[model samples]
Target: MESLLELKDVSIDFQSKRKSFNIIKNINLKIDRKMKYGIVGESGSGKSLTSLAVMNLLSDNLSIGQGEIILRTDEEKVLNHLSKKEMRNVRGEDIAMIFQEPMTALDPLYTIEYQIIEVLRYHRKMSKKEMREKAIAMLTSVGISRPEKIMNDYPHQLSGGMRQRVMIAMALVTEPKLLIADEPTTALDVTIQAQILDLMNDLTDEHGTSILMITHDLGVILETCDRVAVMYAGQVVEESTVKNVFDNPQHPYTQGLLKSIKTLGDRSEKLYSIPGNVPTPDEYQELGCRFATRCPFAFEKCFNEEPPAFQVGSDQTSKCWLHDEEANPNE
Candidate 1:
C-alpha cells in the first residue's frame, strides 16, 4: 500500500525556564494509504501528543525536536516545515482531526450549521447554498435523521452522541485524505460509542480517508484499526498488526496491557492492574529502557542500556532487551 503519513524518528521536546527535555523520543511510524492505524497506551503516553504533532497543533511549551511528519497526497509534504498559514490550508482540506471531547471542541455559542459551514468557508470555495447543502448532507451521512433540524440546534441542545456526529460531519465535509480521531468516543455511552465508531468507519470508507486512531481503549483499536502501536513512557514499545499484538505480544508493556483487560463472568472481586504509574517526564531517565522500572522481565541490561527496536517477526517490531538474543543469551 502507498504511504499516507510517515513519522520518522520523531521526538518532541518540552521546554521551560527551569529545564528542557524530551517527553517522547525517536518515534517512527508509517501510516499507509486508507490504513486505520492505532496508537494505544495509558495516560501520559505520547498518543495524543503524536497526533498533535502531526497536526502542528502542539502548545507553546512543546516543539518537535527532531525527525519528520511527512504527508504524501498530491505531493510530499513535510508537515512540520509548513508555515502556520500553509498548515491552516492543509488541516481541513488534507488532514482533519476529531478531538476527544466534542463538548469542549465545538463552540457553544455557534449553531451546528454555522460551525460546519465555517470549515467549508475557510478551506473550500463554496457559496452559501452549496455550503448549507453539503453540511446537511454530511450530517445525514453520519446518520443524523433530521440534519436540517439538527443544523439549527446549538451544541448544548443536542445529546453527546449527536454532537459527536456533528463533529464527524464537520471533519468529513471537506473530504480530507487523513482523519486524526483522538479518542472521539470517550465522552459517549457504550451504545453511543459503538454507533459513533461504526459511523466513522462507514463514513471514512465512503470518503476513502485514512484514520490515525489514538486511544487508551484497546478494544477500540481492535474494532477499528488494522495496525497498532503500543506506546509507553512517550515511546513506541511495540508496532505490529492487531492480530500479532493480541496473539503474540512482544514488548513487556504490551503483554502487561493485554493482561489488564478484564473478561466477563469473573468470580474474583479483585481486578488486575499494571503495577506502578507511568513515570512522569521529569522522572524519565537519561539512560536505560524507560519500561525497565516496572517491567518484570527487566535484567541488568535493561537498566544499563536502551534497547533498539528489534525485528521479532516479519511484520512486528519490539523495543526490549529480552527480544535481543545477544543481550540475554540462553545457556
Candidate 2:
C-alpha cells in the first residue's frame, strides 16, 4: 500500500525560559492511502500533540527538533520544512483536522454557514453563491437537519452533536486526502459518540479519505480503525492491526490498557487500573525504558537500557525488553 503520510523520527519539544524537553520522541508512523489509523493512549501521552505536530498547529513555544513529516500524493513534500504560507495551502486542501471540542474550535462570532463557507472559499475558487450552496450541501451531507437554518445560527445556537456535525462538514468540505480527528467524539454522550464515529466512518469512506483517529478510547479504535499504534510516554510502544491489538496486545503498557477496560457481566467491586501515571515530559527516563518505572515485569536490564523495536510478529512490533531475544534468550 502506498503511504499518504509518513513521520520519520519525528520529535516535538517544548522550550521554556528555564529549560527545554521533548514531548514526542522519535515517532515513526505511516498512514497509507485511505487507511483508518488510530493512536491510542492515556491523556497527556502526546496523542493530541502528535496530531497537532502533523498539522503544524503546535504552539509557538513548541518546535520540531528533528524529523520529516512527508506527505505523498501527486508529489512528495516534507511538511515540517514548508513555510507558513505553503503549509496553509496544504492544511485544508490536502489535510484537515477536526479538533476535540467543536464549541471551542468553531468561532463563536461567526455563523455556521460562514464558517463552512470560509473553508470552501480558501480551498476552492468558488463565487459567493457557489460557496453558500456548497456549504449547505456539505451540512446536509453530514446529516444535519434544517441545514439552511442551522447555517444561519452561531455555534452556541446548535446542540453539542449538531455543532460536531458542523465541524465534520467544515473538515470534509474540501475533500482532504487525510483527516486528523483529535478526539472528535469527546464530550458527547455515548449514543452521540457512536453516531459521530459512524458519521465520520461513512463520510471518510465516501470521500476515500484516510483518517488519523487520535483518541484514548480503545473501543473507538476497535470499532473505527484498521490499524493501531499504542503510545506511551511520547513513544510508540506497540504497533499492530486492530484485531491483533485487541486479541494479543504485546507491550506491558498495551496489556495494561487492555486489562483496564471493563467488560460487561463482571461483578468485580473495583475496576482494573494501570499502576502509576504517565511520566511528564521532563520526568521521562533518559537512558532506560520509559515504562520500566510502572511495568510489573521490569528487570534490571529494563531499568538500565532502552529497548529497540522487537518484531513480535510479521505485522506487529513492540518496544520492550521482554520481546528482546538477546535479553531473554530462553524465552
Candidate 3:
C-alpha cells in the first residue's frame, strides 16, 4: 500500500544557551491510508513529540535538526520546511490532531458550537446555518447526546468524556486525511475510554483517515492499531505488526513493556515494571546504546558501541545488539 505519511530520519532538538540536545532521534515511520499506527512508550519517551513533529507543532525552542517529514497525498511535500502560512493551510485540512488533554486543548471560554464552527470557518466557506448543522451532526456522529444543547454549552459544562468527544469532533470536522491522536483517552475513565476508542475507530474507518496513535498504553495499542512501534529514550526500539509485536517482541524494552502488562489470573504479588527511568535527552549516551544503561542483557559491546537496526523478520526490526548477526553468531 502507498504511504499516506512518512517520517524519515526525523530528529528534534532542544536548543539552550550553552548547547543543544536531541529529544527525538532518527524517527522513521510510515502510515498508509486508513492504517492505524501506534507509537508506544513510557512517559517522556518522545511519543507525543513525534506526533507534534508530524504536525509541525513543536515549540519555538525545539526544532527539527535533520530529517524529512513527508506527507504523501496527491503529491509529496516536506512538512519540516514549510512556511508558517503554508503549514497553517495544511494543518486542519490535511492533518488534524486530537490532543492528549481535551480540557486544555479546547477553549473553555468558547461555546462548543463556536469552536466547531471555527474550524469550518478557516477551512471552508460555509454559511453560518450550514456550519451549525454540520457541527451538530458531527457531535451527534461522535455519540454526544443532545447535540444542539451540547453546542451551546461551554467546555466546563460537559463531563470529561463529552469534552473529549468535542475535541474529536473539532479535529474531524475538517475530515482531515491524517489524524494524529495524542493519547486521546489518557484522561478518561475506563468505560468512557473504551467508548471513545470505539468511536474513533468507527469514524476513521468510515472516513478512510489514517491515524498515528501516540500512547503509552499497550492495551490501547493492541486494541486500536494495526502496526506498533516501541519507542524508548526517543528512538524506536522495535517496529512490527501488532500481532507480531505481542507474540514475538524483539527488543528488551519491548519485552519489558509486554511483561509489565497484567493479565487475568496472574498470581504475582505485585505488578511488573521495567527498572530505571527513561533518560532525558541531555543524558543520552553520546557513544553507546541509549538503552544500554537500563537493559538487562547489556554487555561490553552494548556499552561500548551503538547498534544499528537489525532485521529480525521480513517486516520486523529491532535496534538492539542482541539481533546483530555478526555479534551473536552462535545464536
Candidate 4:
C-alpha cells in the first residue's frame, strides 16, 4: 500500500507560564492508502491528541514541539507549516474527520442539508442546485431513508444513529483520501455501532479512503481495523497487524489489555480490568517506563530505566524490557 499520511517522531506539548511540558512523546505512525489503522488506548492516553495534531487542529495552548505530519499526495505536503487557509482547503477535501459525538459535531442551529452542503461549499465551487443534489445523493448513499425530508431537519430532530450517518455522509461526501474517525460509534448502541462500522468499511472500500480509527474499546479495533498501534501514557508501546497484536501482544501493557477483554467463556466470572489508572501530567514520572507504576510485570529495570522499542518480529516492535535479549534469559 502507498503511504498516505505519516506522523514522524510527532510530539505534542502543553504551554504554560512560558514553559512547555510534553503531553505526547515520540509518537510515530504511518497510515497507508486504503488502510483501516487503529490507535487503541485508555481515555487521556493521548490517542485523540495525536489524531488532532494530524489535522493541524491543536489548540493555542498546545503545539507540536517536534516532528512532522506529512500528507503524501502527488508530492509530500507538510501539514504543520500550512497556512490556516491552506489547511482549510486540505480538510474535507483530502482528509475528513468524524467526531465521536454527532450532536455537537452537527450544529443545532443549522439544518442537516445546510451542513452537508457546507463541506462541498468550502472545498469546491458548484452551482447551488449541484451542491444540494450532491448532498442529497451522499445522504441517501449513507442509508438515510428520507434524504430529502431529513435534509430540512435540524440535528436535534434526528435519532443518534441518523445524526451519525449524516456525519459520515458529510465526511465521505468529498470522497477524501483519508478519514479520521475518533470513536465515531462510541455514543451509539451495539446494533447501531455495528451498522456504523459496516457502513464506514463499505464506504471506505467504495471510495478507496484510508481511515484512522481511534477508540478505547479493543473489540472495536479488532472488529474494524487491519493494522493497529497500542498506546500507553502518550507513547505507542506496540504496533503491528491486528492479528499479530491481538494474538501475540509483546508489550506488557498490550498483554494486560488483551487479557482484560471479556470473553464469552469467561462471561460469568468477574470481568478483568487493568489495575490503577493512566497517570496525570504532574503524576508522570520523569524516568523509567511511565507505565511501571501500574505494570504488573515491573521490576528494578522497569522502574529505573526507560525501555526503548525493541524489534520483536518482522513487522512488530514493543517498548518493554521483556523483549530485550538480556532481560534475564533465565526467565
Candidate 5:
C-alpha cells in the first residue's frame, strides 16, 4: 500500500554553547492511509522530537540536519521544504496533533465551545450556527456528558479526562486526515485511559484517519498499533509488526525492553532491567554504536564501527552487529 506519510532518513540537531548534538539520527518510518503507527522509546530517546519534526513544530534553535518528511495526499506530495506560512496552513487543517498535556494545549481563558468552534470555523468554512452545533456534537461523540454545559465550561473547570476529551474534540473538529497523539492517555486513570483509547480508535476507524502515536507505554502500542518502532539514543534500533516485536524482537535493546515489562507469576523478588543509562548525545558522538555503552553483547567491533540495518524479515529490520552477516555468519 502507498504511504500517507513518510519520513526518510530524518534527523534533528541541537546546538548550545557547551556542545552541539544530533537528537535524532537517520530515522525512517512510514504510515499508510488509515494506519495506526506507534513510536516507542524511553524519555530523551527523541520520540517526541521525531513527531515535532514531522509536524514542522521544532523550536527555532533546533535545525533539521538531513532527510525529508514527506506527506502524501492523493492530490500531491508535500516535502518539508515549504515556508513557515505554508506549513501553518497544512498543520491543523490537514494534520492535527493532540499534545501530551491537555491543559497546556488549551486556552484557559476560553470556553470549550469557543475553542472547538474556532477550529471548525477556521478549517471547515461553516456558518456560526453550524459550527456551534458541530462542536457540541463532537464533544458528545468523544464521551463528554451534558455537552451543552461542558461547552460553556473553561478548561480549568473540567476534570483531566474531560479536558483531554475536549482536546480530542477540538482536533477532530477540523476533520484532519492525520492525527498525531503524543501520550494521549498518560494522565488519566486506567479506566478512563481505556475509554480514551477506545474513543480514539473508534473515531479514527470511522473517519479513516491515519495516526502517528507517540508513547512510552508498551501496553498502549500492543493494543493500538499495527506496527512498532523502537528507538534508543535517537536512532531506531528495531521496527516491525507489533506481534513480531513481542514474539521475536531483534535488537538487544528491544529484547531488553520486552523483558523489562512486568509479567504475571514472574515475581523473582527482583525486577529485570537493562542496566546502565542511555548515553548522552555528546558521550556517544565519537562511538560507532551508541548503545554499546549499555548493551551486554557489545564487542570490540561494535565499539569501533557502526552497524548497518540488517533485514530480519519482510517487515522487520535491526541495526546491530549481531545481525550483520559478516560479523555473525553462523546465525
Candidate 6:
C-alpha cells in the first residue's frame, strides 16, 4: 500500500553558539494510509519532537536541519522541507494534531462551540447553521453527552476528559487525513482513558484516517497500534509489527521493554528492568550506540560505533551489531 506519510533520513537539530545540537538522527519511517502506528520511548527520547517535526510545528529556534518529510494526498504532495507558509496549509487541513493537554490547547476564554466552529469555518465553506450542526455531531461522536449544553460552556466548565473530547472533536472536525495524537489519554482516569482510546479507534476506523500515535506507555501502544517503533536516544532501535515486536523482539532494548510489563504468569522474584538512564543529547555527541550504557549484552564495538538498522525479517529491523555479518562472522 502507498504511504500517507514518509520520513527519509530525517534529522532535527537545535542551534547554539557556532554549534548544532541534535535531537533526532537519521530517522526513517513510513505510515501507510489508515494504519495505526505507535512511537514508543522514554521521556525526552525525541518522540514528541519527531511528531512536531512531521507537523512542521517546531519552534523557530529548532528546525529540521536535514531530511525530507513527504506527505502524500491523492491530489498533491507536501514536503516538510517546504517553507513555513506552505506547512500552515498542510497542518489541520491535511494533517491534524491533538496535544497531550487539551486545556492548554483550547482557549480558556472561548466556548466549545466557538472553538469547534472556528475550525469548521476555517477549513470548510459551510453555512453557520451547518457548522453548528457539524460541531454538535462531532461532540456527540466523541461520546460527549449533552453536546448542545457543552457547546455553550467554556474550557473551565468541563472535566479533563470532556475537554480532551472537545479537542479530539476539533481535530476531527477538519476530517484531516492524518491525525497525530501525542499521548492523547495520558491525563485521564483509567476508565476515562479507555473511553477516549475507544473513541479515537472508532473514529479513525470510520474516517479511514491514518494515526501517528506518540506514547511512552507500551501497553497502550500494543492496544492501539498496528505497528510499533521502539526508539532509544532519538533513534529507532526496532521496527516491526506489534505482535512480532512483542513476541520476538530482536533488540535487547526492545526485550527490556517487554520484560518490564507486568504479567500474571511472571515467575521472577524481581521484575525485569532496563538499568541506567537515557543520556541527554549533549552527553552522547561523540558516542556510538546510545543504549550500550544500559544494555547488559553490550560489547566493545557497541560502545565504539553506531549500528545501522539491519533487516531481521520481512518487515522488522534492529540497530544492533550482534546481527551484523561483519560483527558475527559465524552467521
What is the C-alpha lDDT profile of model 2 across 92-197, one tens digit per residue?
9999999999999999999988888888888899999999998998899999888889988999988899999999999999999999999998889999999999
TM-score, one value per model: 0.98, 0.98, 0.98, 0.97, 0.96, 0.96
TM-score for candidate 6, residues paired by index: 0.96
lDDT of each: 0.93, 0.93, 0.92, 0.90, 0.88, 0.89
lDDT of 5 by residue, 104-169 (tens): 999999888889888876677789999989988899899988999998899999999999999999
Q: What does the lDDT come to for candidate 4? A: 0.90
Q: Write the per-residue lDDT of candidate 6 for residues 1-331, one digit (tens) a residue.
A: 6788998899888887777688899999999999999999888888999999888888977888788888889654657657778777787788999999998999999899999999888778999999999999999999988999999999999999999999999999988999999999999999998888888999999999999999999988988999989998889999999999998999989988888888887777887778988888887646668888898877878888898899999989999988887775345
Candidate 4: segments with Cα more than 4 A from true spot:
none
Model 4 / residue 330 / CA error / Å: 5.0
Which parts of model 3 are misplaced by more than 4 Å?
A: none
Q: What residue pairs are clashing in model 2? A: none
Q: Give the 10-residue window scoring lowest on summed lDDT in candidate 4.
A: 322-331
Total backbone collisions for each predicted model: 0, 0, 0, 0, 0, 0
Colliding pairs, model 3: none
| Model 5, TM vs. native | 0.96
Question: Weakest 10 consecutive residues, lDDT, candidate 2?
Answer: 322-331
Candidate 1's residue-wise lDDT over 179-235, tens digit each?
A: 999999998999999999999899888889999999999999999999999999999
Off by over 4 Å in 1: 329-331
| Ranking of predictions according to lDDT | 1, 2, 3, 4, 6, 5
Q: How displaced is residue 26 in candidate 5, in Å?
A: 0.5
